[model samples]
Target: MKTIKSILGILVAALFVNTAIAGTPSAKKATTLAVDTKESKIHWLAKKVTGQHEGTIAISSGSLITSGAKVTGGSFVIDMKSIVCTDITDAEYNKKFIGHITTGDFFEVEKFPTTTFKITKVAGSNITGDLTLHGVTKSITFPAKITVAGGKTTATASIPVDRTEFNVRYGSKKFFESIGDKAIDDVFTLDVTLVAGK
Candidate 1:
């Protein structure tokens, strides 16, 4: 009877140890982050008297945050100096125009070196967040299609913002003059995509 009681006690201790291990949180379910620079593109279009200048903006650092099952949130930073005007065929013209954009007339990159977006809420592939640009802060929401399969996930969305809200007021005359208007369309659009793996 003594030996049987000892065996039963050992079994109970082993079961308790297993239960404790199972209840403890494990690192296997931690979130992961991934950024794709090559696949991401940021572009802008501004009109002048004759035509519109369109080109891609550079994304310096873009990231996607994810747990084992779903995406939690993410952040992205844009490099203002990377703005390009493809319409300017001459290098000097491009330099002069882009310089003005980075100065007080437009983005004022020196004062606001980076523009960032932090995701605050996510519901059924839709994301809402605070977007800071040109020293102005605003809350914006956009539709992001999220997909998860085989331990990988991707989210894509597009957002439109008014440039004037951020104090960027360049090209208002030249662009709006054609329409005999003083205020140009302030809305600037952005397309964002993020991909991550487990």
Candidate 2:
């Protein structure tokens, strides 16, 4: 009778252990969300001694990696050829201006056609990324507002980039001297809005 009671207690304890193991949940894995190219937008603002030019640029492709509601990583490819000056209305002058920028003077679109930004770290409201532009890559940190909800993520940031760091030295006063009114500001701003979904 005593042996049987001991055997029954051991079996019950084993069963309880198995049940607890089976009820434990597994760890959740990270998910990749593809960027919605149609909904995402990147606007660029460049300044010179005279005035500023605001334009829109297209994203070629990208994706964001997320774990639960937090954004982990992402990258974006900018289509250099899609640059358009929204503030310029004259067709002839617009064409000339675009040509001047796309040619050897600035950007040199013929040689380096695309730009890319890859996220390295995201902490709080700050994002650090490696920006590859004009055949050069540089790591930059900027503040951004990011939100994840309902299987989608939206991010917006106003990033200021010094064009001279990427070898775009056209009319920058940092490189050229005595060019008072013709000198362009080295820093250009990029206002980006990225939308991604699973």
Candidate 3:
């Protein structure tokens, strides 16, 4: 009888532990945050045979949907018209380069004034989403470092975007075969910095 009671007590203890484990909440509910457009920045680098031009495009608005400390999903819009040339010190030349980029030859900012990225999936620090630029949308996956602390969240990612894929082929040799050394690299790099608050 004592042996049976000991066995039953152990079983009861095990069942109690299992019940407590199952009843405990995993984490808090998801929260939607508004990204600070003024604080977030996107820097772009486009390379050519002679040299390269680097600049930044501003984030107009965005939001991040996070669950506890994990970024579940989000979307952000970029102001294409905010394209600035940071490489050129000459004011006139910088203005010209900025104009050219926003013109029909490159981004066609007059027609497509905004670009966006919508996160669809996030696994660990890697995010997969749809990026829309120049009126063309494509799915892209990139690694990012995301952190949440002190009521603020920050995410940073380095993305290499191929201009030809989005039909921005002004100086690309892939489209104009006879361009020679003046050809620009099809792929460009964008260093992204995002900051948001609850």
Candidate 4:
């Protein structure tokens, strides 16, 4: 009788342990974010002999990592083929110049179709990362204001990058000639606003 009672008690305890272990919740998966391309915009300006031309760059789909309340640095890849500069005035002339930009001269889009930014650290509203452009990777830190509201996230950041650093030397001389040796500024400011839906 004693042996049977002990065995029964041990089985009950084992069953309870098994049940408790099975009921425990697992770790949540990382939240994936989608870049709102329609709401997002990228533009650049260059001085010409006459005036300045402005254009937009297109962003493709990418992912961002986030925990429950914190944003883990993620990667963003930009599409280089979608560069548009409508201020050229002449349609044919603009098309020819754009084609050249896609080649080795400007972006080298064929060899490197995408420019990637990998976030390495996040400090308050400042983000530090490595930005790869024109086959060269450089460490860059920029002020990024990140906001999370009602399960939706929005981040805005601005960074000034030198065109010469990326080997983008088009219209430098002509633009400088127009502006008295200071035509186009080497540093072009990039304003990025990214929205993500949880």
Best by TM-score: 3
TM-score (C-alpha, index-matched) for candidate 4: 0.69
**TM-score for each predicted model, relative to the true structure:** 0.70, 0.86, 0.89, 0.69
Poorest stretch of ten by lDDT in candidate 4: 174-183
Which candidate, 1 or 4, has the higher lDDT?
Answer: 4
User: For candidate 2, lDDT tens digit of each residue in 59-152?
Assistant: 9999988877777899999999999999999999999999998988889988999999999999988999999999999999999888877768
Q: Which ten residues in a row have the lowest lDDT in candidate 2?
A: 64-73
Clashing pairs in 1: none
Candidate 1 lDDT tens digits, 110-146:
8888898888887776788888999898888888887
Clashes of 3: 0
Report the candidate with higher lDDT, 2 versus 4: 2
Task: State the TM-score for model 1.
Answer: 0.70
Off by over 4 Å in 2: 1-26
Runs in model 1 deviating more than 4 A are 1-30, 47-51, 148-152, 171-183
The CA lDDT at 79 in model 1 is 78
Ranked by TM-score, top first: 3, 2, 1, 4
lDDT of 3 by residue, 1-198 (tens): 999999999999999999999999887788999999988999999899999989898999999998887899999999998988888999998888888888989899989999999999999889999999999999999999998888999999999999899999898888889999989999999999989996
Q: Rate the local accuracy (lDDT) of all candidates.
A: 0.74, 0.92, 0.93, 0.75
The best-first sequence of candidates by lDDT reads 3, 2, 4, 1
Instruction: Quote the lDDT for 1 in model 2.
Output: 100
lDDT of 4 at 139: 85
Is 1 or 2 the stronger prediction by lDDT? 2
